[model samples]
Target: MDDSNENVLTGSASQSLLIKPDISTPLIDSKRIDLQTLINKFHNQLGDKNWLKYQSIFSSFILGKLSRNEFENEITKIINSNLLINFHNQFILSNLANSVRINPSPNSHISGFGFNNNNLFNMNNSNKKKKNLNNYKFNNQYEVLKTNIMSLPVKERRRIKNIKRDSGKSNLLSANSSLYITNPQNNKSSSQPREVITGNAVTWSQDIMTGFQTLLASESYELPDKDTLNYRMTGIMREHGLFGSLDENSINVMSMAIESHLKTIIEETIDLVRYRKSKYDEN
Candidate 1:
């Protein structure tokens, strides 16, 4: 009885082991690429004749005419032909080059005064017009007008008052710009009030420079047309613009600057195309 029971147990265990399927086994019946047919289709068209034999060998291996080890060795020899080895070496050298850089993202930001300080610099909102005349300083004459304004309704009174106040303020400031008027009783310059700058005023040179920067950064920043170039060049001869009131020597220096700028742009563009072409060739 004991011997028979042990035999039954052994038989059942053997059956279970046989029933279990291997999960690690590869799907060898998966669809394979027809390298031979593909190569033959291109054989006549292909300038490189070296690839023709590889297709036959690959097909033979696929058809069970060659062992896996023999196929691997032979195919490796074919794929790593002189041309392929040179291409692979070139790829490796390029990867090494891309990994190394003399300067990392050097042009990611601007780097100059009033332009490169953390971000592109801009003037404060001093030039923006105020919504009201509350901050405007009126002259003594506006006081008499304000008294006459009191007779009007509240909303109308306020509107008329502001208009008159602003108008008087503008006239007074313009008059004060030319004259350093002092108190008649004292007749001393020390007693005179210093002229206050109005927010509407801006330096023309600074404004021009800011505009130039915007123009350069704009979408229209292609090489200037002849008319546009002529217009810009003529500005140098102006008596009031950024390049205005300059001597002949200064104008010549500025012309050199324009030439240098255009030359640099063209050369850098050439270098960019060359670099891209070299990278593509390596690939």
Candidate 2:
């Protein structure tokens, strides 16, 4: 009877150990699980489609007390699923991958959109308008500059003629005064005749005038046409020391120097023209 009771006690203890308890195990911390947060993050990063199925699987893993290995297997299953077959889905996936690698800061305040920087968009648009304005100003200034440069040769000829005439008169005065010297030499009187000096003076003046005229007549300088005006303006601006230290690609530097001047002049002229037109209309 003692052996039998000992055996029964051992058997009861073994049976008790074999039977599963009905009591619930304490769940993992809500913070540690974080399945909802992970789902939201995945949705934000990967869009709705890819995150949809994955979110369900993640939820099941968290709620069902699935092992880590099982959770990872579910993730693999979702990844291997053939859900994203459309071009739009592919584009979204590509953008999602890029976002995951370089997560942009959320800009939910301004545009009320999830991930767009409306400020940056506005800035880009403003910059584009500025660029177009600069280009328009450049084109107008280039046209005016071509007209001015092309007129230079004719204008320079008149200037050179005036300068030569003035110089010739000064030379004639000097030659006439110097012709009569204090010393007598070789049968010629110290007081030389006015005719001889006057003749030599006329000859020298004629030679200089002829040379100046020839230079004015030369067509070596070819001014830029309308098609090539912008290219020529770039060269002229560089030569004028406007953009001293900046790189050649610095459009802002070029525009600051060239466009500002042009815009001011053009606006003033336009205002004047409009004023004149309004007065004429009133008349």
Candidate 3:
């Protein structure tokens, strides 16, 4: 009886060990992507030739053979095509990137009068505006006007009432002409404001190419046409008005810009194709 009992106990223990719980074992199947599915997904984003050319690179990245940062950088380069195009339509259209600067010439002549401590003026002989004013004295009306103006608080001096009544029948032009204004310069001089474009034209071409590349990478896979380009370029110059309102020079510039960008995209696409072919062949 004891032996039989021991045998029964051992058998039950063995049976328990052999039988597993009702719960199923978890699997990694959910994590795995089907090959066909992956191929189709990539094919949609990139065209057939591009998919083939970039397959190995993408595969390596997905399979953990490539580091995450390296993969992201490679993807960025592919998308941007290594084009550093960071510019705004507003900046370009407003010509803000091409800022103007007025630089005084070192050789330009400047003359002025200096007042002494005794309240006497030592006018520079070459100063044309003050040349004949040595014997000049302010008229009574103007003197009174100046005195009253000087008595007012600084801000209140600009009030129209201060000059409206005092500035008798003289028209605005005549009143302005009567003021004895002197200038440091003996002669009137002018300098043209110089506008300098800060960036290279290649930036525009690159920017357009990057956008074109992005479009190709999308599902639509459409290229921009002349009308589309015109519309978009007009939008950039919205502050100025529509494309029709643009002057001949502006229109020509925009046309050239669009043509150059399109040309750049084509050239870049050809080069990319060639590069892919070589890389694929080597692999």
Candidate 4:
């Protein structure tokens, strides 16, 4: 063959060889690693005493401090460690990134440069679970208190108020009830009933009791039992001297006391409600 013809034939063969196949095989096969092994390896390399502190490592890895191979190895180590199972996706991802040196794309699979959509979805779901867990812990107690308080009748609440009044010698007024007596000079035989201050004392007492009951019923807590509610109320009242001398100062104090008391109860109740939700989830 002529030299030019030989060169042309060789070029044609090289071009044919360069053409890619319609179906391409993956460079790295994706596989699920054992979670326990991953965790153990992670602890061995980074020390397990303070796992929370190293949570940022996962983020660092995604940002790219390690090669794809090295990152996969470390991630596999973490997954097999069993520790990652306990953590939510955000925690796992952040810690893993921090521990490794790799320029991981925000969307890169732990397996390598190859993309896996499932892992991303799993990570998002894990984060949601963690957030829900935290919220549940906070609201558990509050719901209990609210339910219990709401179940009490207005009359029964009055009886409880009388009991509290008889038990204590303090001049401080119970938020549950108040007494108001009218002078006879205001109206003689008005038939409005004697000692009435435009409104009946019983009615006023009921109103106050109802307000407190409503507050209790609506409030949330980490622990919703009676003991917790009582303790929390007492603490708040005492802090503001709600059960002290009855005067203008005392009135102002009581108002402030109720405000503070209600605030604490509300906050605690929210925590309790969260707890209840968490417990329900566990069950």
User: Who wins the TM-score comparison?
Assistant: 1
Clashing pairs in 1: none
Q: Candidate 2: where is the Cα deviation over 4 Å?
A: 1-41, 77-283
Show model 4 residue runs off by greater than 4 Å. 1-27, 44-49, 64-283
- Cα deviation of 230, candidate 4, in Å: 75
Q: Give each model a TM-score.
A: 0.21, 0.15, 0.19, 0.16
RMSD of 2: 46.0
Backbone clash pairs for candidate 3 read: none
Q: What is the C-alpha RMSD of each candidate to the true structure, in Å?
A: 41.3, 46.0, 36.6, 35.9
Per-residue alpha-carbon lDDT of candidate 3 for residues 28-142, written as tens digits (9 for 90 to 100): 1112111232233334445543433343343454334566566545544333321111111121211211111122224322111111111123345454635344223235336
The 10-residue segment of model 2 with minimum total lDDT is 170-179
Give the per-residue lDDT digits (tens) of candidate 4, residues 239-275.
2224322244544565567678889999999999999
Off by over 4 Å in 1: 1-172, 175-245
Over the full model, what C-alpha lDDT does candidate 1 score relative to the true structure?
0.35
Per-residue lDDT for 1-283 in model 2, tens only? 2422322211112121222221223121111111222333434554544444443453444334455556555555434322322222333223222221212225312110122212211324365765765465457556875787677898775775577433332101121122112113323655777555544333332222222222110132433233233333433333222322334455445446655776899999999999999999999
The candidate scoring highest on lDDT is 4
